[model samples]
Target: MSQPPPPPPNQPPTPPQGGFGAPQDPPPQGGFGAPPPPPPGGFGAPTPPPGQPPAYGYPQAPQPPQTPPPGQPEGYGYPQAPQPPQTPPPGQPQGYGFPQAPGQPGPYPGQVPGQQPYGYGYPGAPVQQPAPPQGGGRKLSTQMQIIIAAAVAVVLIIAGGVWFAMGEDGGKGADAKGTTGTTGGGGKGGGGGGGTAADGPGKEKAPANTASKVAFQKPHPKVTYLTNVVGSWVTDKAYVKTGINSIVAYDLDKGTELWTIPLPGQVCAASRHTEGNRTAIAFEPAKATPPKNFQPCSEVGAIDLSTGKLLWSKSVTGGQGGDDKARFNEVTVGAGTVAAGGTDGGAAWDLATGKERWKPQVNAEQCYDMGYGGGAGLVAARKCGPYDQQYVIIQNLDPATGAPLSQFKMPTGVEYASVVSTKPLVVAADVGDSAGDGSGISDFFSIDEKTGKLKAKIAVDADRFAAECDVTEVESCIKVAVGNGRIYLPTEDHEGSGEYGQTNEIVSFELATGKPTSDKSDAGDRYSMFPLRMDGGNILAYKEPPYDKGGQIVSIDGATMKQTVLMENPGVESVRRAESSFSVGHSEMLFSGGRLFISEMMISEPSDSGVDDDQFYMIGYTTN
Candidate 1:
């Protein structure tokens, strides 16, 4: 096939004037286009048939250019083009390749409405309005006008190039998804959430406790096989159990190990008490060589709080002589003394020197359990007689001399269970009826530490109490705290129909009258709220029920009864197990300096491929 000729440079090929492939009109009779058809008005003679419209065969009269809109410079508007007569071709489609006049709709369906027809100008196309008459009162020289138009075209081209470049690079070179920013550390450590202990007392009061959901920080510095944890109330360093008889100091801020200390024998009991910078750790050691029979743990020792250095070690052999094993059921250190007591008797040593301070004589009539009495001194609860006539004798003793400060006896039929608090005197004991069936109901009593006088007694609701763990094991049992002139109790109440969905609430009671200070129905309920401590007039609680998918740390305002979730635990669902007697064995949660420490023993089920055993995890979280 023969190739079509190329269109001329600087111009496109002109379509037929009226329609596609139409014939062109012949030149005017005067020849040479009749002197360019005389610009618009006649050349000097007002040439025309005296205002008569120009003949159909002649060019139309030129009209002065229309004024462009405001802000448009003069001489920029192009003259309107005159319409030509239309004539369809013999066999070709009408309007095919044809140019239409300005402001007229094109015959083609794709033409835009109200727009100039496509291909109005072609190579060698005639000018719509003849060039303005030379020297006919025009302001700009033809050459100067051309230069200005060229400059304007160049400026528009540069601006378009700059805009296109900015659109491509404006996002700082981010990918197609437009993601470009720094990721921050989650939780309070990055100022995102939770409570800060360094905020000190009275600062950073928690938000109103009405929040139902909370955000949790990702766990960091996770330590495995941590059997126990003891945190300092004033420092970030906490002592964590390393093995059966070993403890190590760990830095909470840096998440690093500090020092480790091996105990003399199997650690039977331990306590952490802080008084300013002087933190004391007291523990009882069982016999290194286990005999077939019961062996008394008569030896006790102490260690420095900041460092793992041993402060003191001593052996006390004075107790009721018999088959009764001599071991301190509990050990507490505070008020310049380290004390340990059990069924045999109680003893106190100087906190600074390890020298024996005093040892109360053991009597066959009374069995005692000793602990710090709210910074006043050491408290000893003495039990006497059988269950039928059981009575509790509470003694407030001086830490320096072991002299009794004050002593009081419980009304007949009351048996001591555990000391809940020393300051503002709160005790957990069982109250029985005169029937003596040993069906004594458990209750909490508030006493005056100074006079040993009873202040108020509150009965534990039977439906709310959880008797799963023995009261002696405070962590697994119901936790009680006294603060802001009120008593806080954790109770389990059914929320939905399921074994794991039971909710927990903190029931508050007025300490003076034993009347409930807040409505129990409105009290906030969680998975399982365990009282941690009283912080700045607020009660910090841990919420974790057996087989819970996860847990949370919550804060309840003492005065307002408001609750806020401080931290959340997404938990490891694959390892979650059902509640069992040994599920919370010896596990405890500690809160100090705006941080919460949790230690738990988890059991992995036996599989054909592996042995069954227990695993321990120590995890920490910030409160702010």
Candidate 2:
């Protein structure tokens, strides 16, 4: 039998009911609870446990001077005199010393009362919710109820195949070079180069055909679990692993580091290989001590993976064409190509030489406006105009040179859309915002692959469907996934007000006719479910709320529009983005060796405002 687990450091001598030693009481369920009613000693009180020697194990938190109440040295916890508000004078940064706005006054409108401000300020603000249900019972709008119902129905759908892993027996493929298990022309995806000839990091020791089970990986792992180590100057021995300090190849069974290969700089984006076998990694050497102006070091290093040699390194600074800052959105890897875009413009490079393949002029100010999705090479982009203007332009690029192979321009404006290269088409959903009364109209458009011509168009009752999901703002339900002869879009009602109305519902349309794919569910909207990819003629979504079920992967049958919960996230919350924010910070999921691999991040409450939390973990797992 296993021995009792050792007590965690700093935990109370008596173990809490939960193995984690979390507070016995559940977290405050709603809005913030009134600040803990001053500590037992009263305001400006001493840290408690009245009889014990000062809780020495825990670090002492700095406290304000004791409050003297009603002529007494210290009585009630309330302050004797109101202290000045904690804020920097005018432009100065408070405490943390970063140039930014003060806390409390929210950056966006409609923050919940008593709740911490969201965004760059407070990290985990309570999720916005509508007013309590009406009447004797909570009268959840039909949409919200459907969302909850869908979640419940999904929980019932969890069964066999939920533990299935993709490419379990290994994938079969032959590239132009007649190499088995290789993808493109040169035995690698991009023009960058091929991985070291040495068997992949886990090639030999990891069994020949079967996929590794989640339980097989070591516990508490780093984020970068498997690297496709490819680049110039790399030796045949180079390998990649999930280990943090060591990205080197190791013997699969013995776990020995094969060779030491350094990255371009500290705090860098993950390295990627282009379809042509070219590898790219951006290095910000000067990030340690930022210069007065936030000019990112423009050094972008590209290396050939096959021969392990650096091919080109460029410093993209302010130039008429794409540069580092503007070009820093995504470096997409596709059929025989790799690309990136810049503010006011974008440029595509020849995967082989890092030479400019194509460049386009875009709105500069709007492109680089301290948000994400600006750069080119993103699978797709939604065009928005200056200052609240919502018009859109979607374009597909030429693989060899990132030129607009096709473009879709809308007369009014489209909120969001999805583009699939395999389908060679772009589908956009547009809904005119309501002036009042909280409802809107929806329109769908399909553009030709070669030219931006509208191949087909259809009208949709967006407000009706959106009402099902009381969605507010842009990012709430803007995800679109294309596959299985259909397009799946997540949406919510467009009640102009910030609060009220948020629900979950997937709007599915036929690929050919642009017609509704499924009858609307009569119940409340589906909640906590986001559209994943369409596979095996089915759509996959997160069936349960992200909070309750960690690592729970679900699938939706494209034909029946039925839901299936595939796998439960083992104590892991899939990464989520805050509404209206830009930077597409990384989410851990990828396809490798014919299997689905995911990395889960373990985060904590920030110690203080403005300071980046240094603590996080990258746990790895296979879908099986």
Candidate 3:
């Protein structure tokens, strides 16, 4: 179809730094300097027009332009002189587009008292005025102006030729819908819309192709800024990535941005409202940019949402105990306190006042997890050693201070996973086998958050070598969450021969009994791309297929499992899921209310020959 015209030619150009013109002196510092005098002419009036013969259907004389009352600026944002109005002959239409002269409506075709014809300019209509000259009438000299104009003309000619030579794809041209024109032709009305779904694994349904008709409607009664992003109902508004760093609050209906809290640097871990409506952001300086003494600086702070302010901040130096390359792995705020994990161990801080509560073990290089046990206390998991054959030490600290409540060890080694909790109970999972054979058998364990005691273990029969097959360890089951008397285990399956990985199958487990509740034998065994559970139900699954360039999300209901395809893209890249979203990675998928919040790391193409930088984004969906 004919494309819309290229942007207009007489578009006003953007001004320089001061932009058009600077304000006349910073807003009179304070008010009430002085009072002004009265108008020279008396207020009383009553001079009628001279009843003279009209010459050749023209009015007797032209009326001068009316100036605004004294004290107001000459024009809104412009200092141009206003033009005067012209007097038209009786019974003749006023100049076409412009309105009639002030205080006098054009003669109506035929109207009763107090009534007017449709589309007529009535009394009290705003006078139309031309806009001010742009760029202060061209600052260049006369010679420069001619040269610039000539150069611009030549450039446009060349550009037009190049655009035309590049053919219809490069410039405006008619498609099968209409005749070609130099630029934009009117759009053609169509009977149907286009639909697309990514061509990838899994059954994907195309999104609706219908367009909504817009109208001036009344506002919805329950609309509020927080409602769009707050999932307080059955699904609970869920977010996964370092939960503390970037806190996104949305207007429930449209998901508008309310505010964002910027950090000094990229964050390693974060948690939001583990205790109250406060967020805790923990970050370690990048390795190559470590602070003095080669120690990565870890910072934790609480954010106040209402005012978008940092309530408090604390710094921990040489106290963290993780991989020299690893960073702040965990940070949580609860019951007036905050805590973060380091290379050697973890540290706690007073939420209101940034005071060190107590210094715990120095596991600076070990993997760890932290969270508040509902209202019970603070809980954390620290790895005792390396992943292939390491142990995870669970600790419960006093909610008020960093006092140790209890410490215990899970039965299996650490493979870097999440610690899911159900108040009194927390579940943990990693890609490991009972014999530590590097087999892909999934290990699921539960712990008592209040006592840090081992509860139970469950094992899944995944392919023995599949767990170790991930070259970059990019895809795997990241976490195990417990709710409604069930546990959710998210896993991944990669099948393609591509550099960046993709997700295939996900599985769910009933960890309490240590058996596979999901039919993993089936290729369709879906898992959570992000942690998700509904009203604490047995259904725990989220699996994202490859992204297409511009596809639509569709819901899948397979006999027993229910899942939603969060994003749909058309190009292979758009459908491509980032490796950072899976297994021990910060990206977490969650479901709250009817909305699904999935955190995915976005990787841009390496700059010609440089490394790629990654950023996280939250995609949400509403089931209702």
lDDT of 2 by residue, 1-624 (tens): 011112211122344476432456654445222233432443233444655653322223357776565667643775556555465678854445333353444323322344322111123223233344456975565445445544544453342122111011111111111111211101111111223221112111112333223322222332222222111112223333323322334322233445443544431333333444455554444423323313242445555544445566554444334443434433444454444443334445555677765544445535321111211233334355675775556666556654556667666645544333235363434455431323322454566656678765645444333321111211112235565445566544222111222234455555565545321111112123445444444444432222222333444444333344444334331222111011111233433322333332122223345332212222233442
Better of 1 and 3 by lDDT: 1
The model with the greatest lDDT is 1
Q: What tens-digit string does per-residue lDDT give for candidate 1 at 1-624?
A: 001112211111354488432466755666321334643643233325666875322334467768667776555465445558776677755455665566344453222343222111112222233244576575765445445545655565566544332322332221221111111111121101123222134322444432222112112123222222322232545535433355555665443667777775544555545554344443435423433323355666666656667777776655553444345655666577778766666667886788998654655665544333424356667666654665677777777887767777877655444556666667665555321222232666777878888788776645454323243422123356667666776654455222213454565565666655321212222244557677766667665533323455556555334455565544443222211111332445665545555543221222344222222244455533
Comparing 2 and 3 on lDDT, the stronger one: 3
Clashing pairs in 1: 193-624, 194-623, 194-624, 195-623, 195-624, 196-624, 197-593, 209-563, 209-564
Evaluated at residue 622, the lDDT of candidate 2 is 41
lDDT of 3 by residue, 1-624 (tens): 011112211112332256323333343334212223322321221222367443221212345666666787677644467678655567866766557565544554322233222211223323233243377565665445445444655565576555433332331211221111111101111111122211213323322431111111111122111111111111123222322224445543355644555555445445634444555666544322323313344666776655556777676444334334324545666567776664445667777677888554445455444333222346665566555566656566666665557776765445443444535455434544343444333554566556666666655434321322211121122333444344444343443223233333333333344333321211121111334333323233333332221222323222223333433322333222222223223334544433444443322222433222222234444434
| Top TM-score model | 1
State every prediction's TM-score relative to the real structure: 0.56, 0.45, 0.44
Could you tell me which 10 consecutive residues in candidate 2 have the lowest summed lDDT? Answer: 182-191
Give candidate 1's TM-score.
0.56
Q: Alpha carbon lDDT of residue 226, candidate 2?
A: 28
Question: Considering lDDT, which of the candidate structures 1 and 2 is the better prediction for this target?
Answer: 1
